[model samples]
Target: MKQWLQAFIAAIQFLTRIPVPVNVPFTNEVLKRSTLFYPWAGCIVGVLIWGAGLGLQLVLPAGPAAVLTLALAVALTGGLHMDGLMDTADGVLSHRSRERMLEIMKDSRVGAMGVIACILVLLLKWSLIASLMTAGAWQLWLVVPFIWSRAAMVWGMTNEPYARAESGLGSYFQGLHRGHLLGAVFSALMLSLATVYIMVSVPLEMAGWSASFAALAAYAIHPWWLLLGAPVLGMGAVWGCSRYLSKKLGGLTGDTYGAMNELTETILLLLLVLMTGWRG
Candidate 1:
């Protein structure tokens, strides 16, 4: 139990800028075990973002609130995943040989391709989030994408081989077993279900539905069933994208894993917006 708590803290520390109060040992084994709690770390991030969005909405319009929320999310993670996304774009869009691409990703300098990709991705995220906010559909359920995207990262780490032979951050995560994947998936699913229930209940209550009716509605419609599809869709997006990257690069790198998470989060948000008709 103590070891598991330490692993969870390690995961939180590694994944986000959030400080863990406990002093945890840093070891290869601890890092490997920390993968088990990556989804949980994402949950923490999602909750913080959701809280920030809610607070911002009190004083700001939907458009500005959404943009601020997005900024806060990026700031919270210190743009770690975004950095990965840029690195990936720099490499993959160069259209060079795989070796050259990898070298470019490893390079500290950000190329023009990386800058362009970052702008496009952030723009899309801002637009989508604003749409959701305008529709009042941005709720506690917003955490779903964050949870599943990190779970997808774990999936990549578990299923795909690390691209580089040299020591790096990605190397520490290689060789994870199926058990790690199962742990992440389980955590993600449980969180998803809880958020779905909250999402459904909120609207039904606003409509003056009774407690029993709200429970039934939560199981039946409004958001539960639709929102439940998010993880499934997110996992699918990650799997297909990761597979393509693997084929192109010969294996997955830390940068590709970050790219997978960012892409999955964006895709999931798009799906939710479309399903809810938020734009209309």
Candidate 2:
């Protein structure tokens, strides 16, 4: 139990700018094991972003609130995933040899492709989030994508070989165990289920047991049920993305892992917006 708590804290410390007091040993083995808690770390980030979005919605219009919420999300992660996305774009879109592409990704300088990719992704995210907020669908479901996207990262690390030969952050997660993948999937499932129960099931219970069960049945058939498909979509996206990146750059890098997370989140948000029909 104590060791698991330490691992969770290590995951939090490693994944986000959040401060944690537990001083777990910082070793490759420890970091690999900490991958099990990646989804939980994402849940924490999601909760913070959700809270900030809600607060912003109170004082500002949905469009500006959505922009600020996206900014806060970026600030919270210190743009770690966004950097990965940009670096990946710079490398993979350079149309160079695999070796040269990897070299470009490793370079500290940003390229034209990377800058363009970042702008487009941020704009898309801002628009989708504003649409969701305007439609009043920005509820607990806001956190689901974050959980699954990190889970998708874990899925990539577990199944794909690390691209880089030299030691770096990505190498630490190479050859993850099946158990680690299972743990991440389980964590994501429990969190998503809990969110749905709290947001939907509990409210329906007040009307009576039958009404609650009926609501659950109706919800299962509703368009919103598509939200439950996020984990499957996220995993599929990660696998397809990893395969594509592997073909382009020989395998996945730390930057590509970040790219996968960002892309999965964006895809999930887009799906949700389409299903909800931009309510407001």
Candidate 3:
């Protein structure tokens, strides 16, 4: 129990800008075990998005609210994953020898292609989030992107071999067995199930006070099967994207893991927006 608690805190410390204040031993075993909690760390991030989006929409318009909420997600992660995305973009898009591409990704400098990729990703997220903001009830969808994205990283780490010849942050997580992979997927599934309740929990409480809220609560209760698709898609994104990157790079790297994360988030959010439109 103590070790698992430590693992969870280790995950939170590594994944977010949040301060744990407690000492966490980052042993190889601990680090490997920490993979299971990556989805839980994502749940922390998701709740932050849900809370911030709700608060921002109360005082600000959808445009500004979406901007601030997106900014908050970036800020909370300290741009860790975003930097990885940029690095991966610079490496894989260089059209050079595969070895040279990995070398470029290791460089601290961001290339022009990297900057372009970053801009495009942010624009997609912001626009999709803004559109979803048309109905505040849809804010719960915002939380989900972060959850599956982080979970996708776990899937990538578990399934793909590390690309780097030299040891890096991702190396510690290499050689994870199927058990770790199952744990991570389980966490994502449980969290997605919880999100279904969060979307309607408030409305359920307010239903007695307002006829409109009662109607909204009834509408908000989605079939549980609707969200089961999220974790499934998350795993699929990692399998497809990581396999491609592994083929090109010889294996997956820390940057590729981050790329998988960002890719899954965008894919999930885009699907959610389409789902909303189709429902409408």
lDDT of 3 by residue, 50-121 (tens): 788888988999999999989998998898888999999999999888899999999999999999999999
Candidate 3 TM-score versus the reference: 0.90
- For candidate 2, report its TM-score: 0.90
In Å, residue 17's CA in model 3 sits off its true spot by: 0.3
Ranking of candidates on lDDT, top first? 2, 1, 3
lDDT of each: 0.84, 0.84, 0.82
Worst 10 residues of 1 by lDDT: 214-223
TM-score of each: 0.90, 0.90, 0.90
Please report how far candidate 2 places residue 151 from its true position, in Å: 0.8
Q: Output the lDDT of residue 96, model 3.
A: 86
Across 83-132, the per-residue lDDT of candidate 1 in tens digits comes to: 99999999999999999999999998999999999999999999988877
Prediction 1 global C-alpha lDDT = 0.84
Clashes of each: 0, 0, 0
Please state the error at residue 213 of candidate 2 in Å.
11
